[model samples]
Target: MTSPLTRNEQNSKSRAQTFGIRPDLFQAAQDHMVKKSDLDELSENLANAGVRGFTAATLPQNIHLGSPDSGTADYAILPFTDRYGPAVAAHPEPPSLQIEESGLWTVTLNLGTAGHGLAPAGSGFFEVSIYVGPEQPAGGPVRQYDFFNWRVELDHQQSFATTFTVDFVVESPGDFIYVQVSGMRGRAIEGDYTRTRLSVRKTDNRTR
Candidate 1:
C-alpha cells in the first residue's frame, strides 16, 4: 500500500472534480504545530494531503486562523480527522504547540501515545526536533532540535518527557513562533506541527 500522504496526493488528482487539497499552500502553517499533549494530528497531516481543508497551526492555539475562530477547540489548528478519516499515522491530529511572540523559552514534549508513541516502542530509528522561529517555507530550519536523535519508547502508561532548556531567539516578537516535533515512521519520517508558548526571562547575552 502507498503512504497515506501519497494516497492523499493521488486522491487529490483522481478526485480533483470533488475534493481539492492545496496542502502545499498551507505548508508554512505546519511550522506552527507544537503541544506535547497529542501529536497524532501533525503526523496525520504528513500522511494526508488535505491540510488546506483544515486549519494550520497558529499562535494562541485557541483560535483556528480561519473562520469559526470561536470554535470550541482549544487548538490553533485541527486536522479534521472526522472529515477526511484516519491516516496510517500516529494520531488523528497533529502536534499542538503554541507560539505567541517569539523569544527564548523552554519546551517540553510529552509522549502521550502509550502504545505507538512513535516508532513502535523500539524501532530504533526515531528522532525528534523542535524548530522555533517565524514562518518558513515547507522545509527550512526554523529553530532547531533539542536532541540530535531523540526516540520515543513505550510509555508503559507514562509520559516521556524531553525538555529543551535552551535559548531560542526569533527575528521579531510575535513572529509566528512554533515548535516542530518530527519522528521517523520506519524509513519514512514525518513531522508534527504545533504552536509554542514562548517566554523570556531577560538576562545578559553573556552572563555565565
Candidate 2:
C-alpha cells in the first residue's frame, strides 16, 4: 500500500502536468508572457526602421457630374478633402497626396458609386487610375502608375462599389499621388463621399 501525496506534492504535480497533453499550448502560454514594455520597444524599433507610416484621406462630399462628354474618354480626378496621419498632406480640389518621404508604398483606393443618372445607359465599364508625379508644376501631366476597370450594370437607382490596391515605389519626396475615374460609352462616374477613401502606407525602408 502506498501513501497518498501531501498537499505540497499534489500542488507541485499539478503544476508540472498543466500542459502535459499539448506542448503547443505550453509554447503559446510562454509567448503570451511577453511584457508590454517589450512589445512597445519592438514597435518603436520597427518605426525607426521606416516600416510604420500610414496616411489616409477621404472625399469631403459626393461628386456631382454634369452632362457626359461623348466625344472624350479621359479620366477625371477625384477630390480628397480629409486626411489622417502625418506621412502625406492632402491638396485642394483635384485632390492629390503630397509625399513627405521617399520609400516603397502600398496605395489603396476605395470607391462607392451612387445610384444616379450619370451611369451608363446599359452595361459598361468604369475605369479608375492612379497617377504619381511631381507637385511643383501643379496641374502638369503625370505618369499613370496603376489602373483598374470594373464592369458595372446599373439603372438610375442602383449603386456600385469597388476597391483597388497597388504597390508603388516613390523616389521623390515631394511627389504627388492622384486618383481618377472615368466611365465608358459616353457616360460619367460619380461616388459617395462617405464611402470613398484613399490610403498609403510605407512597406519597406528603401528610400531612393
Candidate 3:
C-alpha cells in the first residue's frame, strides 16, 4: 500500500493533468512562461520605435506670390497655412517642421501653377528649392539644400506642376525643413495651393 500524497503534491498533479503533461514537465514549464511585466515592457518599446513625420500645405486663396518682376533674382518661402504632425509649428521665422529625433529623412515638395495672367512673350522658367537646417533666430538668414526648376515656354499660357524629392540624414534634433519657389526674370510665378504640399518623414535609424 502507498501513502496518500500531500496537499501540494496533489495540487501539482491536478495541474499537470489539466495540461496533459507530466508533473515534472509542468514544473519546468513555469520557468519559460511569459510574465505580465515582460509583455508590458515589449509594448512600451514598440511604441517608442514607431515612425515620425510632418506635412505642411497651403490653400488656393492663401498662396503668396511676388511682384510680376520679382523674377528669379531670389526665392521666397511658400506660406503654408495648414500643418499636420507632432513637431510642426507656426513660429521661429520661416515656419518649418522641427526635427524631434535623429535619423535619415526623405523630403518632398510639390508645386502647381495656373496660367491666369499673360506671361512673358518668350520662354520662361520656374524654380523650386528645399531648405533644411537648424532653427534660426528671428531675422536670421535661410540656408538652401536641394534645388529644382521647370522650364515653360511663354508662347501660350498654360498650367505647370512638378515634384522634387531628396534624402538626407539629420544628426541632431531641433532641425527645420522648408520650401521656396521662384520664377525666371520678367515673369512672376504663382502657385495653386490646392496642389502644393511639403512633407518630411523619418525613413531609417541612421544618423550619418
Give the top-scoring candidate (TM-score).
3
Q: After superposition, how far is residue 159 of candidate 2 from its true place, in Å?
A: 2.0
lDDT of 3 by residue, 86-174 (tens): 44311122355556667887777766665444344555555566667774423333653333444445432556667778888777776
Alpha-carbon runs more than 4 Å astray in model 1: 1-104, 117-122, 136-162, 184-208
State the local distance difference test value for candidate 2. Answer: 0.62
Which sequence of candidate numbers ranks them by TM-score, best first?
3, 2, 1
TM-score of each: 0.30, 0.60, 0.64
- lDDT per residue, candidate 2, 1-208, as tens digits? 9999987676567666665534456667878888889999999987677655577777766664435555334455777767744543233323777666777887788878754554455554555667776642244345544444444444544567777788877776666777767654333334344568887777765865
Q: List the residue pairs that clash in candidate 2.
A: none
- 181-202, model 1: which lDDT tens digit per residue? 3332322211222222222232
Better of 1 and 2 by TM-score: 2
Residue pairs in clash, model 3: none
Best by lDDT: 2
